[model samples]
Target: MSCRTVASFISLFLATTAAVQAQTELGNFSNVARGGVATTFVTDFQAIGINPANLGRNDNARVAFTIGEVGVGVGSQALTRTQLRKFIEDSGEELNMAQKQEMARTFTSDNVLNLNVDATPVAFSVVLPMVGSFAFSSRQRVTTHLGLNKNTAELLWLGKDAPIYPANFNPATAPLVSEVLEGTSIQMAAYNEYNLAYGRQVLSLPAFVLSVGAGYRYIQGVGVVDVRSKDGQLEAYSALSPQFNVDYGSVVNNPSFNLQKDTDKLLQPVGRGHGYDVGIAAEVGKKLRLGASVTDIGQMTWEGNLLTANDQKLKRLRSNGADSYEFFSELADIFASGTDSLFQYKPAQERKASLPTKFRAGAGIRVGSRLEVGADVTMPLNDVAGNIPAAFYGVALDVKPLSWIRLSTGVTSGAGYGMGIPVGFAIATKVYELGFGTRDLRGLLSDERPYASVAMGTLRFKIGTVK
Candidate 1:
């Protein structure tokens, strides 16, 4: 393969693990895109995941499907330049002309791609005039994947050469020369959540309309690996030689050919867990709406083994009077002991899957018979240690020039440090409705950024009529 391809592959592999944390945290919140409904009783499937009570508002048996992309462009420049210089020095001699050229080309490609994640909801509801409204809805919660940054290739070059050699190499040297190359990798898997919810509208006094809802959120844990190295490199060769030769000699001489050496550690911890959500929305007047919800109120536990090999070998070599047989025997015992003790367990104490429990209140005003304006403010009540509290404010204008078509434009703030402009259109008839939206135009905000914008489109179909 071309050097650029190699670099791209390495860059992608290493980035896969490093970017997973960001994916797991950011991917869960995009479920809010399914917010619009056709009737004031708006039972759009999207809101069902947010607040089950909204499910009771559905006057019709409906199925909603939404496809969306949530892209983020983020880059960081470190204060140290010497690290880059050192990396060049170490890998300069081993790289062929082809590898050098490929590395250069791969570094320039933009890191942007659509998040390409989607959510769909299918619902059936029945509303008894004076009794209450009940509904059942299921939807895919959230999914995300992130690619690696090309700049990391520069760092990989630093570990390309070392002083030791593996059993697989034939080198001309005095006192035995070996080489080592170290590099970091990132890997991420698709994150998925399944949500099932139930909601009802309760009648109290005539002063206000009260709605209550609860949901079960099932979160699938994700695994990631940040750094990985192959045996062909100089370091792996150097490190394996002494052990390899001793084992080879012992095998040929007698029945006892033990090599009790421990391997280097490269694997990271893997973890998974689940949680729940409950919410309520109330309508005090014709144009006023208020809502509050608590999400991710539980913790997810992560436990897994660390990946590493060869530590025991190094230890054996350093021990006084130690031989190849001793090292092999110890190594066997370590592996035989099982992987349960290698993993360090950590618990997730953050609320709402790191997104935070949010309280929202908004108001809608009728400008004319054909125009309506609305605004909402959402505040996060809990804080995950070391993370900033996120708050979002949004305003939207809907213009209905005809009975079947509606145009919308709005701006959402608090994504990070800037505001995202979301613009879309909705087309509805008695049988079906389709909507499309685009938000977060600050794609050019960072050079090492992953996406230029995030957009979504949704289609809802009326399945049956409910009395």
Candidate 2:
């Protein structure tokens, strides 16, 4: 393809950013609650797929069971839960022009909103005196992004009743813009993974104990959607439904970019692969611990029901409108393509993808019998197709006033966003444990909308024995 085509392709691809089941490499919120500090603080099956060496440190009995664990965190700068309720649940309430205007004012050219979720329905683990420790679990992870541009926002605030696009929108005289406007992306994806971990003591000394281990993981990619653009003639495409509607928006001069997609079917294992995690941990004396690891060094090949979307034809847009909120709203749809459009999509045979490889290290200190503190840092080593998580750093403190009760809180940042205060608690006994927490405590503390936010594992439950 030509340079322009390649540019168009790159812009569109990067704009489409979301996961069907988005989760940071740290995985769930319980992990987040403890500030996602992974170099330490692990003592059970929770260590699997994280730092395998941690498996050998579960001072509990020989076996453990996990009934279920699911977490979700969704935050946005573009809209609030109240606003979303007004739009989706308040059936009797209709949006007024002022409300629409207020909503439109929230979006900008450099904005990002997203959601991440991770879950483990069931799992099991065991420790053998001489054989080390072993465990197995399953997980679902997803990430999604919401984006908006200047032109798209204008369309939603004003209607196409009059020509808003004059040859030269003189900024000095009129409250208008002349440049090719930017657009938004409603991109997403989710996938599943099966993981097995084993840990064994590798070294013993007068003042230190060291362990090493690894995790074998199998991944099944169930869903994917890539749609976006950085520059060129402004345009947008949407398929509201598979068999019905399709919509398109473009400037009068440029080719109308279009897309037709039935992405629902792709939300299954259209691709599969295997990877591994290797790690080592050391206990210095009895109050301090340290660990390091690397993970997801593998690739996946998507061969089933492969497809692509493209808009090559030139087409006419509806009545030219400089600012129409309805037009922009209709322009950014994630599912259900509209009825008519210049964009078209076709099924391809196959594709190859690399896993999101990662490197992490951490350390923890036991301040006393009742309080423990730790810190961890993780970085994505590769730009895996479905995983673009940012490097993260965190520090967490856990307090156990009673054997059956645990409280934790910490500060963390990265994974592509701002800093967060995470806090949560756990109620546990020999037979079961229940815990909850959030990585995006900013959403709870601030009244103004945050740039990026998250909430998950607040309602996590696991009915398993420490024995």
Candidate 3:
């Protein structure tokens, strides 16, 4: 089949199986904090990803790995006593007990459904610094999403038996059914980033030391649907049909086609992209440091085909039979047959894969031989449509009470007045060093305190010391 034809089939499948695929969240900034303040020690790995100039600052060779988890929840509530009274007045009869029960369940569930997400980031990096302040490093990062459960599922399943159309069969009812069925989808996505970079000091003038560096990056993302159901038995109908169930989800046993086949086709050809990073860092005074970098100035393209299945048996059956007899057929034929094929593709539109670009600047000041304070500001340079701009500001204090002990603390602020505090400690001997830290302690406080709740912990050990 032609590419256009395949794309049309995919689009139709997505629409039909709308309830089976859930919305996915991408390009979150929270992962940035994993590098922390001590990033300067073996910081070359994170520097390539955060700020390229960072590679010039390290005097030692080291390796480090960090793992972190982030969880976010958002909800809203309103007092609608007046609106409820008006609603009752408009109804001729008082709401029965069953109606009241449903109202209570819906209100409670809606409030809980808003936005709740949990993600884990695993990262590792190795850095080697050579004579005359030159360094090379490699870093790898992966983000794993657990799952998303919007409360709408309960609401849709509860109302499934309700008449989709009253005696009038108005066109408005069709949209209402579509909206209701959209709630029953399952979505999951995973992202991986790999970077390799090299850095060297270019100038060591009397007033300052200036360094520059660059690197390449490779990124990949995949999204999958594990379960999907829409408008009661619609999915089951598609699954049992000879055309749809065999063509898609064939790897799984006893698949239920709750949505149109075109829905699955729309999500084909998972997103992939690559980009580059550049950085510069300068030491202004004996004890002062400043740096900046930009990353991910690249675009990705999505490619896939679309297929629609029409169960002719469904048109002649009722209830369960409608789901069991559905079949995969051409979109043109379905349109001609006069049965709504939510699985038809729109040939004119293309889904572009756009990644966010980021810019960051930071400064650090050393106090005597034992203490240092630093701050950084980061913002999105460019973002895709409908993507939110993320701005991050952080300040940290590092203390060396003895050659063997290092302590640090910092606060970070971001969009939406969100803020967090991180505390860390590291112990070092001649041959080995260990570190631990807690980020986003604001979680210990309430929302009224001017920040979102967040928490993170990390550990790093030195494998070998540089000469």
Candidate 4:
């Protein structure tokens, strides 16, 4: 192919691959609080998601069980818990102008909103001596992204009744406060993943040990939504919910989404695809180690509960009646309202999508007997279907004070998510282990909080005869 054709092909490949870059709920709370440090010392089943090559770290424990694993990241700086809670509590009531303005002030054309949920439903892994380590896990990864354009904010606070939208309301100069900004994007995805993996020593030397691994993943695409725009034009596609109805609004410039229905079959994944992960790790003279890996190099074909909404070029839109706080279900109805209203809701045709592939390079060093430190840089190869995640680099330290107690802490910042200090400890015995940590540990000590994250898991259990 010609060079121009190759460039076009590469662009198309990226556009497609960007749709699947998703969330952080894959590793355990320990990994979550350690600034995403799995590329270094991950020695258990968690390695399946972190670095399959770590599976080669090898242990005599032979078995591990992961339970109630959950992680949440609210990647937005516009609002806080108190504000979000207050908004929810008042969603059912009418909002006065002041309240509307307050909400609008928190939103901006450059504002980014993302919601991530990573839960491991069931997981287990085992070492088979020279046969390598084998593993499988069912995980749920969901992410939602929204870029609030100035116009959208206007629709929120001023409604379609704003004088700016009136036919004769043109002004000589753009309003200094609300200049016409570039259009924003809104995308969401939820899917269930079943991963099967194997990793073992691929090479060995007198002074170093090298391992290579690969994984096969089955993806059940539950739902996906993508609304991308440039300048002021937009186009949207949806499968985010298994099924739904959109009662599009008729108000000029005022579009509201009213999503309804679907109690029977949302869990049955609407789309299906498969992909794989491959990695390599080398331990240099027992104390220094290096590794690299690429994961989620796969695709899902969305075929069920699909919908699309092209921008309406709306001149008027519905107002404050949508956003709410007191209840969750009704709030969803208002949230999904006619935002995609003007577009005809059709049986979305099946389309192919790629997962957000990620690349990681990491290093670690063991300083003495009980203290170990590591760092890693992880970045998505392309923008995913939802929000664009920032590349991150952070360092972590793991210290063991006693055979049964381990302490870990780290700091991370990048991808516009801000900085977070993770401090946690793990208590492990020969047959059982308990681990807990928080990505926002600093929040507990000061009001100058940077991010809001929750990391906790109690059902984590492990059985081994090794110390």
lDDT of each: 0.36, 0.57, 0.40, 0.62
For all candidates, the clash counts are 53, 36, 28, 30
As a TM-score, model 1 comes out at 0.50
Model 3, span 265-317: residue lDDT tens: 42222445687778888888778888877766676443222222222221111
- Predicted structure with the largest TM-score when compared to the true one: 4
Write one digit per residue (lDDT tens) for candidate 4, span 1-467.
Answer: 01121112222222322332222444477787686776877766787766788777644347777776766655465656565435423436655667666666666635345556677877788887668787788887766665666655555455644444666643343332213324555566777888888888887786898988888888888666665566555555555442323232342122332232357764766678897898998898879989899988888887654555444434333444234332222213212333413233344466677788888889999888688899988887866673236687788888989978888888776655566677877886667767767665664444332345566666766676322
RMSD of 1: 14.2
Higher-lDDT candidate of 1 and 2: 2
Off by over 4 Å in 2: 1-29, 58-61, 78-81, 84-105, 109-111, 149-186, 228-268, 310-343, 450-467
Ranking by TM-score: 4, 2, 3, 1
Summarize candidate 2's per-residue lDDT along 299-389 as a digit string, tens digits: 8766543444543422223423222322323432211132222234443455666677888899899877788899988888974434544
lDDT against true structure, model 1? 0.36
In what order do the candidates fall by lDDT, top score first? 4, 2, 3, 1
- Displacement of residue 223 (Cα, Å) in model 2 is 1.0
TM-score of 3: 0.53
The most accurate candidate by lDDT is: 4
TM per prediction? 0.50, 0.72, 0.53, 0.80
